[model samples]
Target: MRIVVLGAGESGSGAAVLAKVKGFEVFVSDMSAIKDKYKELLAKYDISWEENQHTKELILNADEVIKSPGIPNTAPIIRELEELGTPIISEIEFAGRYTNATMVCITGSNGKTTTTSLIYHIFQSAGLNVGLAGNIGRSLALQVAEENHDYYVIELSSFQLDNMYNFRANIAVLMNITPDHLDRYDHNMQNYVDAKFRITQNQTPEDAFIFWNDDPIIKRELDKHGIQAHLYPFAAMKEQGAIAYVEDNEVVINEPIAFNMEQEKLALTGTHNLYNSLAAGLSANLAGITKEDIRKALSDFKGVEHRLEKVARVRGIEFINDSKATNVNSCWYALQSMPTKTVLIVGGTDKGNDYTEIADLVREKCRGLVFLGVDNSKLHTFFDSFGLPIVDVKSMKDAVAEAYKMAEKGDTVLLSPCCASFDLFKNYEDRGNQFKEYVRKL
Candidate 1:
């Protein structure tokens, strides 16, 4: 079968390699220049690929297409495929067909990365053969091709979940659904929510579906979507059916064998991280990991990069890099964790963000605001009347410098941007790395 892979980055190249390994004719095309690392990897496999252009003649003849999660469905080629009735699937979906391994899939507007990483650490530390893939480590397709493991812990974005069909998660986790990437979902909250709910699409009664029990959206959606999978709901405090909950300052998992750990001793702290730890704990316990092993892993896990990473203390001022908080709810979590007044660095490609979610937090915790993006008009429109001193800058360097100048000795300079970073940076990692490099100099 002739398989065409679109957007030859990590996802596309991996899918191409996997298709080749499976003895299929695979062609990779990226409209932008492919990275040298991916180019080399593709060449090493003796697979054919093209960069800086997508040849319609080459792509349209595909038996199927594996699309990179970064590419939207509105892309001309994707639209063409839809019109032709040609099946297009995500790299995750294609990879799932070739592996019978247990899939522990995670998705949400926030906390998926940290939760995915924590669960992976638990499983790996418990002496289980596991591969970290999807949105975190290597692409699932590449891992499926080159390695054999009994389980894969995957982090799914709504974009990755969109093209997925027939891919069932042995264990599915929806951290919490908020208004995120609405720009890609026709600026509709329901559309984005529907895309996230796709994580549970193909599950059966034997499969497990984990979620935040307290999320109003999840609660509302649960009433509408009839899920066959066994429900494992978690929350900060115990409710009617929360399988995992906090009690007397102890994190507790009731089912899959009772488990508890001191909440204060958890390596990750903060209200948001409490939920992350709860989800990870439940996932670990369900995998038959010993309670002691789960506890140790949870206590020692350092945390994910760019999601509230500490940069440095400059002249008694703390600089935090939270570039991974790419939505209003994420920034709310970041600000909610602040111990002192903050000079908030926020702004980017507006993803139809409603700043009101973090408005109260901004008023309470932020001493000033740094608008760091190509366009800060939307940020200005909402935050302008908040009466905080606002500074606008296009580059991370200037943004950091201005934020530093505004911050006092005890205040924090937090780069908790609540929108996509495409306007002034490559991606969140690039934005975070730059924030750290510039911060270290101060």
Candidate 2:
């Protein structure tokens, strides 16, 4: 079968390689320039690809198409493919069909990477033959083709979940649903919520569906669309028969067996990470991993880069790189974890962000603000009433130094850009690395 892969980025290139390995006639098309590494991979596999354009005739004639999660449904090429009645599937869906690995997929507006990484660490520490795939580690398709593992832990985004029809996880985790990537969903919260719910679409009674019971969005959706998988709800507040709950400062996971851990002993801090720890711990227990294994993984697992990553402690002023906090909710979580007053370095590509959600947090925790983006009008307008010291910086170094100057001993300089990082840096990782480098130099 002729398979056309759209967007020659990480996901598309990986899909093309897997399709070729499966003896499918694979062709990759990207409107933008393909990266050198991906181009080399396609050439090594003898996969035909077109970079500056998408040949409509060639792509439309394919038996199936694998779309990168980054490509929106509104893209003209995608819409055209849809109009032709062609089957367009995500890389995850394509890879799922080729492997019988038990899939443990996690998705959320925030904390997904941390939770997914934590779960993978737990499974790996337990000596399970597991591969970390999806949005973080390696390409799922690439890993499936090259390194065969018995289990796969995937971090699914709503975008990746959109085109997947038959892809079902044996164990599914929905960390919490929040208003994110709504710009791609026609700015409709329900549309995004529905897309997140797709993670559990094909789950059966034998499958387990774990989610946050405290999030109103997830709770409302759960009430609206009944889940088929055995429900395991994790919560911070009062919960009865909740598969996972915090009581007396201990996380209780009552499942096939019962397990408890002191919440304060978890390496990851904050109420948000506590919930994350609980969700991951519950999954580990359900998967038959020992409580000791879970505890070791939870305590030793360092944390995902760019999310509350400590850079340096220069003269007692703590510098935290939370460049992955791309939304107000993520920034709120970061701020909530701050033990000291913060000189917040925030700003980047605005994704229709609602700063109002974090206004009170900023007012309380932030001593000053360093806006690091091209335009700071929205931030200025929103924060005018707070009368906090606000400055603008065009680069990450300036943002860090400016914040450092403003922060006193025992103050925290947090680079939790509550917006996307495309305005000033290549991406969040680049932004975070730069921040760390500058902090180390201080």
Candidate 3:
């Protein structure tokens, strides 16, 4: 079979490697320059690849196409492939075909990285042979091709779930659905919601589906979808028959195996993290992890980078790097966790963000706002009535400096953009790293 992999990034390169290992004639193509590491991997495997342009003839002749999640369905090439009746799938979908491992897949607009990492940590601590893949770790296809394990904890995005058809998770976790990445979904909330629901599409009675029961969107949609997996609903409020819930300041898991832990004992704080901890604990219990192991993992997990990560304190001002907070909902979580007044560094590629979600939090928690992006007009217009000091900056260093100037003793400087990082940084990680580097110089 002829397989064409698009984008030549981590996912695309990994898919090409897996396709080659499965005896498929593989070709990798990327319209942008392929990274040096990926190019070396393709060369080591003797796979043919091209960068900076796509040869339509080569791509059109493929028997199958594995697309990177970053590629939109509206791309001309994708539309052409669709019109030609060629099957295009995500790398996850392609990798699932070759692995019989138990898949623990997670999807949501927020907290996916934290939840995926927490679950993987729990399983690893329990001595389970697990591969951490998807959005948080190495590519799923790469792991399946080389270091195949008995289980995989995968963090999926809506884009990935869109192309997945026959792939089903042994354990599927839907954290919550918020308005996110709507541009790719034709500005339709239901479309994005439907895409997230795909995580449980091919499950059976033996599989388990864990989700946030309190999210009105999930609650309203759950009854409409005919999911075959056993439902495990988690919430901050105690429900009569919930699989997981908070009771008397303790988090309780009632299904598969009963376990309870003081809410304060969880390493992650804030209401958002409470939901994350509950979901991770429920997943661990469903996977047969011991209650003792789950408690230990939940308490000791260091949390994902760039999400409420504390940087060094400079002259008593706390600095937090929440560069992963790329949406208003994520920013709201960050702000909600602030114990002190904050000098918020925000702004980036807008992504059609609705600032109203975080408006109350901003007005209450933030003493000032430092805008960091190519343009700050939208932010200025939205925050004009906040009556707080606002500064506009074009670089991470400038933003950090402005935040420090606005911050005082007992104040916190938080870098939670509430927008995509493409305007000023290569990605969220880069934005976060630079924030730390600049904070250290203070």
Candidate 4:
């Protein structure tokens, strides 16, 4: 079989290696320059590849193509491939064909990374042979090619889900759906929601689907689709028969095995994280992990970095890097978790964000606002009437400096840009590392 993998980044490079190991003729092509690390991997595997441009002849001749999630269907080359009747699938889809591991896939607009990590921790604590892959750790394809595990906890984004057709999750987790990456969905909320719902696709009755029961959007769409998987609804409030819920300051899980833990015992706090913890607990339970192990893992698991990570406490002021809060809803969660007066660092590449969702939270928690992006006009116009002091900074260093100046000794400085990092940094990780670097310099 001839396999052409597009985008020689983490996912593509890994997929190419897996294909080669599986005895397929493999080629990797990336329009942008391939990172040196991935270039080395391709050569190490003796796989053919091209960078900086897509060779039409080489790519079109493939029997199947594994596409990276970053490349949208709107690309002309992708459109041409569709017209040529070539089958294209995501790396996850291609990798799924080679693994017999029980797939525990998590997807949603927010809290996916946290939930994925938490579930992996729970499985590990239970002494299960598990691999962490997808959007969080090593690429799934690479892990499938190199490691042997009984299960995989994958973090799936909507873009990754779009190209996944036959891959089925033994246990699927859907964190609450919100307006995110609407531009990629053609500015349609339903389109984005539909993409997220694809996580449950191809599942049978034996499979389990865990989701937020309180989200109005999720509830509204549940009636429209007939899902075969067993439903496990989790909520902050107590439900009569919910698989997971908060009751009397404790999170309780009732199905598969009855378990409860003190709410304060959770390593991750905040309303959003409560839901995340519940989803992870339920997934662990469904996987047959003991209740005691789940509780222990939940209490000790450190949270994902760049998602409200506490960087340092300088001069009695706390610095938090929440650069992964790249959407408005994520920023809302970060703001909701702040217990003290906050000097908020926000702004980046806007994705038609509606800031009104966080307006009330901002008014109540924020002492001042610092705009850290290429343009801050939209933020300025929106918050102008609020009568709060707002400052604009052109770089991460200046933003951290300005925020520190505005913050009082008892206040918190948060770098939770409610937008993408493409405007100023390479990615959210880069934006977050720079924030921590600048904050430590103080």
lDDT of 2 at 367: 94
Off by over 4 Å in 1: none
TM-score of 4: 0.98
lDDT of 3 at 136: 76
How do all models score by TM-score?
A: 0.99, 0.97, 0.99, 0.98
Backbone clashes counted, model 3: 0
RMSD after CA superposition, every candidate: 0.8, 1.3, 0.9, 1.0
CA lDDT of each candidate?
0.93, 0.90, 0.93, 0.94
Q: After best superposition, candidate 1 residue 282: deviation in angstroms?
A: 0.3
Q: Compared with the true structure, what per-residue lDDT tens digits does model 2 show for residues 1-442?
A: 9999999888899999999999999899998899999999999999999999988888989999999998899999889888989999999999999899899999999999999999999999999999998898888999888889999999999999999999989999999877778789999888999999999988899999999988888877886767789999888865764778888988788886799888778888888898789888988888899989998888888889999998889999999999999888999999988999999998888877888888888999999999999998899889878999999999888988899999999999999988888877888999999999999998
Model 3 lDDT per residue over 253-293, tens place: 99998899998889988899999999999999998999999
Best by lDDT: 4
Model 3 steric clash pairs: none
lDDT tens readout by residue for model 4, 31-145 = 9999999989999999988988999999999899999999999998899999999999999999999999999999999999999999999999899999998998899999999
Error (Å) of candidate 1 at residue 350 is 0.9
At residue 415, give the lDDT of candidate 1. 96
Task: Rate residue 177 of model 2 by lDDT.
Answer: 77
Looking at model 2, report the run of 10 residues with the lowest lDDT sum.
237-246
